[model samples]
Target: MTQSQHMQIQKTVFIITYGRSGSTLLQNMLNALPGYVLRGENANLLAPLVRSWQGLRRSEQAATMRARGTPSGPHQPWFGYEAIDADQLGQDLADVFLRQVLRPEADTRAVGFKEIRWHETPALFAPMLEFLQRYMPEAHFIFNTRAHEEVCRSGWWKTMDRRVVLDQLESAEQLYQDWQAAHPQRCLALHYNDYAQSPEAWQPLFEFLGEPYDAELVEAVLGRKLMHMKWQKPANRP
Candidate 1:
């Protein structure tokens, strides 16, 4: 499809979390919803696209500087890609995502993906987050987190240093917190323990996404283990 053609995205939802943080379980529950479709861990696909965009801006800046007889340096302002029409770019991105990463099903009402790697370096994820925000202003974000000690004990962190793991988790939590603070209407901060202890905790999530709460589906999803990480109750759970 041509970039000029517009894609009408009903809703765009992003699931953001660090590894072994019950993100996969949340993904499963979100996927079970009637209108939402979220793909898991597409960092391999998304990271390249964002980096390529950065590269393209650098190249564009160099060429523009050459044309203006100005020396381009590392300190030059990043080109904003303002030349590209916002709506067209947004639609083109949607097309690329749906076609390449997550193909739309017949009844797909909302589309998005989940990735844990973004939490490792939230700074690197900033440009991509900005891209999503600018293009899909209506997009909703779910910031999922698990207890620090519990995450450190998980198999995913077994080989890693506990201190480093804790720091990374803290950084991830802070990134999400900042985003939520800045755009409360567009983000939801959810803890894995809270959701596990009471499945009804997902009511806020469903409300955030403008979806009907399906108690039956939630119960069904909870009945079985969807992700490899088993539910771990936190020490401070009330």
Candidate 2:
């Protein structure tokens, strides 16, 4: 397939975060902008797809190493890491994402989704980021975070989901930091507390996205009674 066939979207924006980290709010805000529609989470599909690919690579590595009588030694699981064709994997994943996750809309100049599982599946971040960088040249990433304690206290965590929440958040943050360091212009790190305190605090994000900042739209969406829990902070208090 041609390179453009694999990367059909004009611009792809990913809001990567742990659950209960205000990614939905970020999505809503971005969607309010003209020609931008950042959809909700798709971890149910993305996580399993990524895990299966990793498992397949590991299984192949084990089979190959055993057949060749090669000692796996300390890095047994990643024994054949170098043998994996990342470019081919990238192409496959790009096709999967375009087919499964994104919804095509002619009016949408940028189409994207928010996914929380990137935190739990930290190993997939680098490869996926590389793939995104290669295929979707105009891609932007928003790494949203809330306070660690706040996340732990949130409903999502309190409901018996044990995925090493803190560790996952830390690892995800590190991934975001590393990616942002390399591509400063295309990555944005945002804090839920800051944005919740003042929806207008997201002006920098709008600026980074080259979208006009609209305080009214921010207030309109944020002021409503939504399904998600209230941010519990005074609006414009900060």
Alpha carbon deviation, residue 177, candidate 1 (Å): 1.5
Off by more than 4 A, model 1: 1-8, 55-94, 227-238
Model 1, residue 163: distance off in Å is 0.7
TM-score of each: 0.78, 0.72
How well is each residue in 77-177 modelled by candidate 2, as lDDT tens digits?
A: 66655455645775577666765567646566787788777745567776566556665548888889999878877764655444576776678788888
Provide backbone clash counts, one per model: 0, 0
Task: Report the C-alpha lDDT of model 1 over 1-238, residue by residue, as the tens digit.
Answer: 2322224457778888877788888898888988677987765366556655555555655456556654545565744333434346444675576666766566667778887777554555666676666655367788889989988988657568899888888887888888788878888888999998587898998888888888888888888766454544322222
lDDT computed for candidate 1: 0.72
Off by over 4 Å in 2: 1-9, 47-89, 159-164, 230-238
Indicate the residue-level lDDT of 46 in model 1. 61
Instruction: After the best TM-score superposition of candidate 1, give how far the Cα of residue 9 lies from its true spot, in angstroms.
Output: 3.5
- In model 1, the Cα lDDT at residue 118 comes to 73
